[model samples]
Target: MLRTLWKHVAADLTLAAPLLRLHFHDCFVRGCDASVLLDSTANNTAEKDSPPDLTLGGFNVIDEIKTELEKACPGVVSCADIVALAARDSVSFQYKRLLWKVLLGRRDGTISRASEVIANLPPPYFNFTQLKQSFSSKGLTVHDLVVLSGAHTIGNSHCPSFDNRLYNFTGKGDQDPSLSPPYAAYLKTQCKSLSDDTTQLEMDPGSSLSFDNHYYKLLLQHEGLFESDAALLTHKTSLNEVKKMLISRNFFAEFGQSMRRMGNVQVLTGTEGEIRKKCSVVN
Candidate 1:
């Protein structure tokens, strides 16, 4: 019942969607214990001395909604649980279809550090081997890696995230020469210049808002925008699994299952972490 209500509250705060997803991704990949959110600061470190973009972009919106939740439910609801609920609910809100069963009662971590973000988050230029290692480090299989990458289906990547792909890819940076001619041509147009905006690159061209097997379909057609995405197609084990899911109704089913599993990943629960008065800064 609490989880259900939190879902609605999260939807009322639209932009909280992605922030919530990221929180769960971090927890699931590591543990719900918030260790992943910790950063390394050798000496005295203040928030100002930390990374400027410390909070996830939409975290302010999430913080507002969380404040409302606190008022209504007081200490009953945990911020980590809210993060998980918001992630699943956000996807449902976007797709208008139920995908995952989210577990609740995850407590918030007291610690959050910028260095952790730099260490855990996968780099854009990461190849298949590096990605596999990263996922493995988190106890996830290659299949989980592929499915989670599908989150790109609903989110937008900034130009900085993919700039190296556009300007530095050996065969073709922005437009890979190996990609289908038409698709390559389209990407060339999309990423014409370094200064060109990348938020416009829709993961699924026709229906950017919907979550489906389109990302997999894109990989099949060689339209994957990032090297990490495109690499899924190169490995037979991972590629075949992704292909099977793309063709079957099981794609949605498995995606939801994977998402639920992701939500349960190493989260800081109980008294391990604090519920930040502000999602961006520790209280």
Candidate 2:
């Protein structure tokens, strides 16, 4: 089913990381109830409108898939399940293999307030200790933090996310001491205009589109695009996990495990929540 749906998507090369991120944002706030897909109403703003979630993609793809599923099976499927499936399918597209199997039966929540986004979704500038606390708030472990950071192996970022690293790391107008010198210079050229929201910087340099261990490899060189990525090296636990994945061929297995754990965050099942007719609005 996913293979057939993949053929119709426009940006085939991308979408994996965004779908995964959408799920992350959804789960972190109010559980994975498809709340991230809610559209803003006149009375209130939606989570999608929040600053941290502003760059989130794959909404249209999920909506299209929901429309098709509703036509085929009525109310049998949930938007939350569709997103989880889409995330797994998107990753499989790049890996050319299955990474994880998603569990269904998740329901959609009707609430989406933009005000709740930033508090739940931490910024890229977060340091190691901060990132650790952020993940811990969601019931994710230090190991999960390092493993899921591997998703940076794919996807691009808006220039503002890490421009401070390239232009002004310290108040003295110097680049971040933690970032690689040559890589920082390269980023300066790529992000000449710090305010350019249209410009994108690849999270993973050579293998940005591939779901591999390249993210860990780059962090070892201090070429990570965000302070959060570099933070993995600051602590003993996260650093060991990074090095473990770097040398072990079973990174895929560990990633799958961590993702499954992450996906289960505050989930609503059984009699909780409602199944929406459309992903963009409440029924």
RMSD of each: 4.2, 1.5
lDDT, model 2, position 85: 81
Off-target runs (Cα >4 Å) in candidate 1 are 1-21, 28-55, 94-97, 171-175, 197-199
What lDDT does each candidate get? Answer: 0.62, 0.85
lDDT of 1 by residue, 1-283 (tens): 3355346545554343355455544563335543333333565242213442343444444556668787777766665666666566666665554467877767666555554554666665677888888877766778888887776666555555554555655745444554666875666566766687534566557745566678888888887767788888777888887777786477777877777666666666567666655444455
User: lDDT by residue for model 2 over 1-283, one digit each (tens)?
Assistant: 5854466433577777788788888888887889999999999999998889888998888988888889889887889888888888888885566788777778888888888888888789998888989999989999999998998998899899988887778766778999999999899888986677788978997787788898998999999999899889888989999999896466788888888887788788887888889999888
Regions of candidate 2 where Cα sits further than 4 Å from its true position: 9-11
Residue 210 error, candidate 2, Å: 0.9
Residue-pair clashes per prediction, in order, are 14, 0
